[model samples]
Target chain A: MSPLSITSRTLAAALGGYGLASLSAMALAVTLPMARDQAVIIGIMVALLLCSGAAIWAFSARSAWRAWAGILAPGVLLGGLYLWGLPA
Target chain B: MNKSFRQSMAWLHTWTGLLLGWLLVAIFITGTSAYFREEITLWMQPEVHDSTLQPGTIDMALAALNAKAPDARSWDISLPGPRQTAAELRWQPAKPPEDGRRHRGEQILMDADSGEVVAPRATRGGNFFYRFHFELYGIDRLWARLLVCLATMFMLIAIISGVITHKKIFKDFFTFRPGKGQRSWLDAHNATAVLALPYHFMITYSGLLLFMTLIMPWGIDAAYENDRRSFFSEVFSRGEDAAQPGSPGEMVAIGPLIEQTETRFGKPVERIQITNPNRDNAQITLRVNRDPAVTDRQRGGDPTQVFQGNTGELIDTHIPANDPVSPGWRIYNFFTSVHMTRFADPLTRWLFFLFGVAGSAMTVTGMLLWVSKRTQQLRRDQQPDRALKMVNGLNMASITGLMLAIAAYFLANRLLPVTLAAREDREIQVFFIVWLVSLVHGLLRPNRHGWIEQVAAASLLWFAIPVVNIFTTASHLFTPLAWQHAAIASFDLVCLILAALGGHTLWRLQRKPLPAKARRAPAPRPFNTTNPASEQPAGESP
Candidate 1:
């Protein structure tokens, strides 16, 4: 793939991941406050840190797969946290 | 200097910008208006005009509050001063055992002298615009905030890539060559982006940081274990817990407290918070700080001091200039100040306003750049491709459509039935609905027609705003001008001028017919050009 396409895809993926992390973090912040649930809040915070790291990596990395993985990890992890740990 | 890198950056700039250009337009418009939030509030409420400034002591205000709301849990009084006409009072009723959210509160606008509630109407004043930028109406606030963050991210990339794409950033700093098609658009985008680079950077970064809790709450969550009050107190040194009463007795008079607060702060008291006003545990916390010049210097830092309720003792004072707290605090304050323009003098505010206009222009020109480049390419290829056509349509809707939607918001503010459910929200609904309608219209119409029609419609709506205000309400340009409310009057005139500018733009674009050469196929060279008889005279070719 062309460098431009790679960069665009990487940026889009990073944004998608950041979106999920932010949504999960927000859910935790709101729901945790009401439920007095600390564990879920911590879980979301850990997911956010991972997402921030992925964004940084995606921004700096040259390899396409590495950039894609860097961008995708946060979204996948947040999804897992929401599905398993969070109440519907 | 690398051609490929430049090409890649150009591609990055174009797409990144296009993806978020409409959102950025809304942010720029709303953000710019937010600078004049107080002025807008002044304009909205015509009933409270130039009231007498109250000189009564804080003790008198506290006495009034105690009499009015004896059983209230917390009472807040905004002292009547120069900028504000009425002494505003707020108090929370006893919270029910069921939920904290059901606590009843009242915002009383007092007669500066008698301290009686007068002209009490629930109206979203200038604060609406200020809050609207981050918290868009209808949708979840978190969603709106997240969208703004995403836009800011795209904006940062666009600005960086835009600088790299510009070959003559310095040389074309002041250059503006109108009627030069793509060159003019590029020059416009470059000039605005470069001239206000610092403003753009500071505003976008600060906007992100303003909601840093939402964006990056991990640090606060981990450190304070997600306890909001503790997190705020630790970072701001606010000291959340109030002092317990030493001995249960009648509270001391607020007049002496006011005197002590004024003597210590050397500024007029702006607000006073009373805890347990009627009870023996009552404490009046007088906040003395309201010099915009000095407060602006503090950036986003709280420049006020809190005093003990009973003894009038100093509790806590925050002087942002005296010491640097945390790096986070300083950064947060700097950005917040930039966003709020609280530090801005009139001239500086105007400069920020002008730069805001330039920022809006940059987004419009960027969209135009895409359309202009694609049109040129399609003309060269001798066919209008489907992708190019769709882009052209989107450019029309995104640019002019946004202007129309903003105008629609103003119109809705005036025309919507006052009794409508969630009236303030209805104005925002009109804004989005109008914009969506324009988008759908653009999709249906021919690209050329869409541009002309949407711009014309926007111009009309914009021009109609002041006229509507004049007819619908007592506050018009004439009255405000007569009263020497320059801020309010000038705001209306500025809108008119913008409308006129939009009209002129639409007129020019509509007048220029599509070039015939752009539509027709290129002529083939004569086959028998080498034969002298067959070849016509150079200028006489059929």
Candidate 2:
């Protein structure tokens, strides 16, 4: 593997993956119809698993750009969901 | 990413497993030791070794507390249990000094039988290891927790990728080939990892969950409008009585209350909390030893009974098993409780300890496999590069060096003067100092000779602990008191077991390792025809 490719993938796995997980957690916490504490807990639990899955996706993609695309695409979707679900 | 999905996973596993393998090994070792932290603390305090269980222990402790802190606001008596030899007495004075300062409380150790106070040497005991396993020592708590969280994340990814990469995990569980150098290391790693697969997965996942608030707080922030404290108080709701003390009156005997609670729970009383002592409104709360179920919350789940101290009448009873919990919280409790293993009996605790050993072995063998694979790839007469040598040095230090440091820590506890100023901090200093020395030694000599010498040194240190205990403490291995106190005896036995393991490692190392020429080389692979069932290459590049 090229140095630049490895470095980019590593960044995507670490930073982008974290961003995606956070957005998902926020989205689930706000949107899920349950007790606030239970929703928060389920959100955190799912977020942790998604974080690891993000790492796997970051490494498994065909190219560095694809790695960033895979993480960021869902991240943007989750971010939008989070804002839309926020209490008015 | 590589040509195939499995190849990519193998690559991911190799890097993730190697990058933080050192920290994971240390965490596993120390965290595993935390299973017996109370026992370890008891063993370290030899002064209380002679305090065996007695039927009158509770009365003795209460009598002593009554004499010592008669006018205190509250008294807490922790009764002796299977792992404990002394009853702990703590009291909060009714009034603090006029000056504005935090008066925490006063506490003393009382022998179970005589109720006489005993002063154990001032040492951190097992708490040092228990704390170091997570937040680490001398660093900012938040930063240390974050660092450990990052490692745990990496461990989770490594576990997932490792499972994907090992195509024959089930088959490999039954296969162990010794005397084959790199292949043997790989086999041992696979065996340990696959054997305790559920434990490895649970431990890594729960480790991340333990710090969810610090690492993944977005959920709580979004749900509660950034009010974390309210969230915690809501989840762990407790009923705190705010009753004022009544007129002074004679209180009823405590023995019957204890017996009544024990009969109700079918478990011995673990602790007694008395408020408004010697008053008409005095309330005694008895918490029995935890009888934990798989889904029970770790804290606040003990079977407890409350009594009217003056009348000796039952006021309230709480059976934690009957508490209603949502499925989400139940799942969370199950994972966290299993990870902590606080509910385990002696046999279950020992089983968890052995599983922890297996986890440590998995990480240690993985590190060795990395080095062995790279070392085998080197052609004859080709010296190892600087980076390779550095990695080897770190591997040795994090493994053998850590063992040496722990031994030195125990030795320091015994060797230091009991009255020495800041004795606890001094003992910790000895641990870090020895660890630093081992790192330096590993860097100076990261070869066969270095490995042999360090392992030998660590083995001798482990062997020396029981010998040194004879000269330093009354709870030596040969003493009847040590036998009576199973904690102390088991502590010595574990040390000898460790020393024997080290000796076995040393003995195996003495047998000359296979030459580098005989091991497999990292060459371009041809399609495997003989093993048509498995098409994966024998060696994959990092």
**Whose lDDT is greatest here?**
2
DockQ of predicted model 2 = 0.74
Residue B478, candidate 2: how far off, in angstroms? 2.0
- Candidate that would win on TM-score: 2
DockQ of each candidate relative to the true complex: 0.07, 0.74
Residue range B218-306, candidate 2, lDDT tens digits: 99999899898889888866656436767888889999899989988898899999988888888899998777586887677888999
The residue-by-residue lDDT of candidate 2 on A33-72, one tens digit each, is 8998999889999999999999998888899899999999
DockQ of 1: 0.07
A1-88: candidate 1 lDDT, tens digit per residue: 4677466656644675566556566445434433322333343444444444444444444555656765566567655654453434
The number of clashing residue pairs in each candidate reads 1, 0
> Residue B521 of model 1: what lDDT?
50
Query: What overall lDDT goes with each candidate model?
Result: 0.63, 0.85
